[model samples]
Target chain A: MSLVLRETALAFRRAPLLSALSVTTIAFSLFVFGLFGLVAVNIQRAIGNVAERVEVVAYLKRGTPLQAVALAAADIEAFPEVESVQHVTEQEALARARRDLREFQDIFQDLETNPLPASLDVRLRPAFRDVQRAAAVAERLAALAIVDDVRYGREWVEKLDRLRNIAGAVGTVVGAAFALVAIIIIGTTIRMAVLHRSREIAIMRLVGATDGFIRRPFLLEGILKGLLGGVLAVGLSYGGYALIDAYLLRASFFTAAQATLGVAAGGFIGLVGSLVSVGRHLRST
Target chain B: MIKFTGVTKEYLKTGAALKQVSFHIARGQFAFLTGHSGAGKTTALRLIYLAERPTAGEVRVSGFSTARAGPREIPRLRRRLGIVFQDFQLLEDRTAEENVAFALEVTGARHTTIRPRVMRVLTQVGLAGKANQYPRELSGGEQQRVAIARARVNDPVVLLADEPTGNLDERATRGIFQLLKDINASGTAVLMATHDLDLVRSMDAHLIELQQGEVVYDSAEDAAGRQPVAP
Candidate 1:
């Protein structure tokens, strides 16, 4: 170890209270950053997972034949965006209605024949499961001569898309904000370290020590601060991830909670790294 | 050797403290700068240390003109000049030996060379046995002696003392002067700024008196106590 390192060790040994406070501040800030990070990650994952379940339903004309419905289903399945297609015959539709509304069967008892329409259930490929793709597939299917109508939870899907966009944008902004905060916190922490040892700096100047040699101790000090804060933040964030995931699982929102925790860890790392570096530099000088 | 020509230093509130002052000290020479308070003695000493640049004129020390000295050369110059202050600014936490070793450490003195050199200087100042003691544990006289040991560790070409004995008793003051005289006899020039007229008179050394800001009397006292170089 160089003289400054050796002396820096002595300086730390002499002032436990001051060093502990600085490190604690770093850890606390990192923990907060980690929490926000978790919120963002899970939102993204939940949006993606939910989008995969969305699909379009195309209803055929009331008198359409089984062969026509089957051919249409096969044709729809061949589309680049379509994942798969299932043809529902009028008989199947009637049976489903009978099972669902057995008590209301009297309301339709006067019907001479079932007027139920056969339909094609189109599941789009995962890449096209978003609102735009779902809407486009519905429009395209409705344009077909054999299709009479197309339907889906249009407003709900639109709202989900909007929410996903807003959430993703917020995640970006929050990540940037945390990064900036980490830099400021580190810089201020290091500045405090510098102020603490100004006398030693003056003495170093008097003793014919170069500026580079004088700054070494504080740099080491900042790194130690970062490492301590980093370890704490990482440790705390891991616990937070587990706790949040467990709560989400119990509440049946596990997917979102899991996704968000990943962001939390990233935030923790950023917070710890920036502060320790800045703190050490500020103190060393 | 040192020289001051047409040197002037001033602050806005405290007008000119040194004005067009001119003096010179030759190689291996000792001098006393005697003055009352606020007589620019501290300012004069400060200029030699390159702590304050002069408002005017040329001041030179150890062959380099300090007025024209750049930042890089300042440390080099300081390494060659030993300074002792009235407050005896020793690190209170360090051993007497460590305190002395600081001077050598800064100048890149090897660790193996520090121990014996520190011991020799402490022995010279009659503080050898107390090397392991910290400054706070020592008496005022002993602390001053430790300060002297620190100054001498670098084997500086010139030693400057500013009221070194202000905090000491009469006998202690006498001993401090004797130590300075012995160092000067061994060839390092000593410039002491003091108000101890009784001590100055008994020592029989060259004397320069400054009142207000300018020198009023210049008696370059030889070893036998007579003005040898008249200006």
Candidate 2:
């Protein structure tokens, strides 16, 4: 353990510039990945909020008995996908229309009979709030004997779902590409380090040092680089997030758990990249 | 102890570097491998150290057959032998003591054991006062001494020197040779490869001369015992 630490310290002392360059490259790459993660998280939260409010409105036929309407409402309420169902009478519907059209309330007073149909407002469970499932539920309601029409904003919900899917796919592809670049950057840095210390390696081999002995210091060097880079990336990402929140009122987009995961992933990539580079060079020599 | 029986090494780029060469050095025995450049003297030493394998025959070092040793076993085999080169190969940024400590560090020796052992070897090589000096600050002879101290730090059974005096002045060469002789006197077998015929003759040690890739002479059997064979 002391040997590893000493060698790692020596390596850093030997090439401070190169070490810093590697760490900075890793930090920037992880920062980009963290930014994408933040955006994706916010997009998902927004989509979920929109989906929660999705409800199917079923209009009853004119002159339908209240008892039949109540029976249909009870049947809809029994569905696994249904969260809650509210029955609105004709008078209540007319009153709601009057409240919504307050600027023209005098026109509603001239009508002797109420023109608004009674309806059932059906709220769906969160899991069944997707466009396809909600549309399926609305179709089943329309087939009921008392229901005259069903509406669930099918077009708008579909558009929102498509947007969410596209965002997720884009985030994944971009994140993977950035991760690949980080690995390549770290690999190149470690390869340069191996080349720089070729003489030391040759001497180590000459003095009966095993492959593991020679590789330990370099492996430790890579781990240190990755750890430092991870810390830097986390700091930069959190600082950037705070700035965004202060300026645009978008605070709390990235959670602490997500930042931890991102840093851990970055550190792991750095370690793997360093190992591959060192292993390749050692094998070739 | 080292033995090479009908050893042949063929490189793709250079063809056969050594052809059917055979030799042996018993425990506590010292010998010189004398030849011109490309005469396979270094190749012979490398075989013993497991740096290169015999293409056609066997090489046994410290009772382990290098030909059959796996990658994991090679280092274990190497630990029984020490190697020195023409270039000092010392880490320029490190102090002389640290360079010597490297050998012990690779073997996972304890820190308390490493410092005393390193200082003892440095003092043995007559560089005790220069232990804290870097390679760049040390003279050529001092740097080479540090390299020798590093090789001796592990107390290997067989010390292989590949042109150890190639880059030294005559005075420094004499000092280095005397140091190697002192090391040999301590029961560590030494196999030194060099083309300095005059030096080889003056030492009165066993000499195995190589021409091309074949053994041309073996002083152990006297010059009249073996004729020069072409590869």
Candidate 3:
């Protein structure tokens, strides 16, 4: 173990330029991947905010009893997907309309009787905010005897669902492509490091060093380089995020857990890349 | 002890490197493997070290046979034998002492014993005073001495030298040959491969000469009147 550490340190000292080059290469590659991840996370969040507006509104018939309406509101709130059901009285609806649509406030004030209908506003749970779930809840609300009509933005909800699916598919496919590129580029970089030490490896073998012994130092070097690269990559990604968030529209960065996962992913990639690169060199020699 | 019985090595591109060759070296015996560059001297040494397995037949060295030596067994076998090359395969980044200590380290020798063992071999190779010098700072002969010290540090039963003096001038060559002789006097067997026929004539060591991958002469068989050679 001490020998392995000594050898790894010696290798870095022996070829600092090569080591730095490989680390920089890994960092840039991971930075690109991290940038894409940042974009995906922000897109998902934006879609989530939009999905919060997907609620079903059920307008009651004019003569519906307050007791019946109250009972119906309690039943709807009991549904598994229903987050909350608020009942707005006719006067409250008129007041809300006057507030929301100020251009029509004059006409609302001139009216002798309230022209608005009392309604139940149904907000679904986050997970149930998609088009199919909203439509299903609307169908149930329309079945109530007191509900004259129910509206849930069917076309708009369907369009949002399509956009969400497209974003998800693109995120997965593009993320995978970036990850593969990082592996190949990082693998080649590690291979160069192995090749640089080919003479030392051959001599180690001649001196009766086991294959496992020869591989340990290189593996440690790779992991260290990867870890450094990962940290640098995170720093670079943050710099990029800061630029965009400051100059452009508001954006979100990775959560702490997600950043840690990105760094761990870098280490994992480094380990795998070193394994393959050193394995080939050992096999060939 | 080392023995080769009908050992044949075939490469896909270069074809047969050794052809049905057979020989044996008793414990603590010195021998010479003489041949032209195209002959199988290096190939024979490689077989002994398990660098290349025989296409046919067997190579048995230090209780490990190539036929049965798995990946795990190869290192064990190699630890019992030391290998030297014409290029003096010392790590340029390491000092002479570190180079020698590397062998003992690989064998997982006691940490307390490593410094003494390395110093002993460096002294044996006449490089004790130069222990801290890097290979690049040392002359060709001194570099080769570091390589030999590294080879000898493990207390191997047999030392295989493939043109150990090939890169040295005549003076250095003679000095290295004498070093090997001194090492052999310490009871370790030596198998030296060389194209230097004059060096072979200077010694009464056991001789096995090869021509184009086949053994053309064996001094032991000739002395025993079992096989006759043209010259």
Instruction: State the DockQ, from 0 to 1, for candidate 1.
Output: 0.35
lDDT digits (tens) for residues A11-126 of candidate 3: 89999999999999999999999999999999999999999999999999998999999999999999999999999999999989999999998999899999899999999999
Where does model 3 sit among the CAPRI classes? high
User: Using TM-score as the measure, which candidate wins?
Assistant: 3
Give the per-residue lDDT of model 1 (tens digit) for B1-231: 788888999888989998877777776678888899899899999888777788999999997786678867877888888888888878777889988887787777887999999999999999999999998899988999998888888888899898999999998888898998999998998999999998788766667788888877777534464544553
Deviation from native of the Cα of residue A44 in model 1, angstroms: 4.2
- Per-candidate DockQ vs. reference: 0.35, 0.68, 0.83
Against the native chain B, what TM-score does each candidate's chain B reach?
A: 0.94, 0.95, 0.96
**Any idea what lDDT model 3 has?**
0.92
The fnat score for candidate 1 comes to 0.31
Residue B149 of model 1, lDDT score: 86
Tens-digit lDDT track of model 2 for B1-231: 688889999999989999999887778877999888999998998888888888999998897996678888877777777788898888888899999898888887888899999999999999999999999998788888998998888889988899999999999999899999999999999999999877798887878999999989887665576543321
Misplaced by over 4 Å in model 2 are: A60-80, A83-113, A139-148, A238-252, B224-231
Order of candidate numbers by DockQ, starting with the best = 3, 2, 1
User: Candidate 3, after superposition: displacement of residue B36 in Å?
Assistant: 1.4
Every candidate's CA RMSD: 6.3, 3.4, 2.3
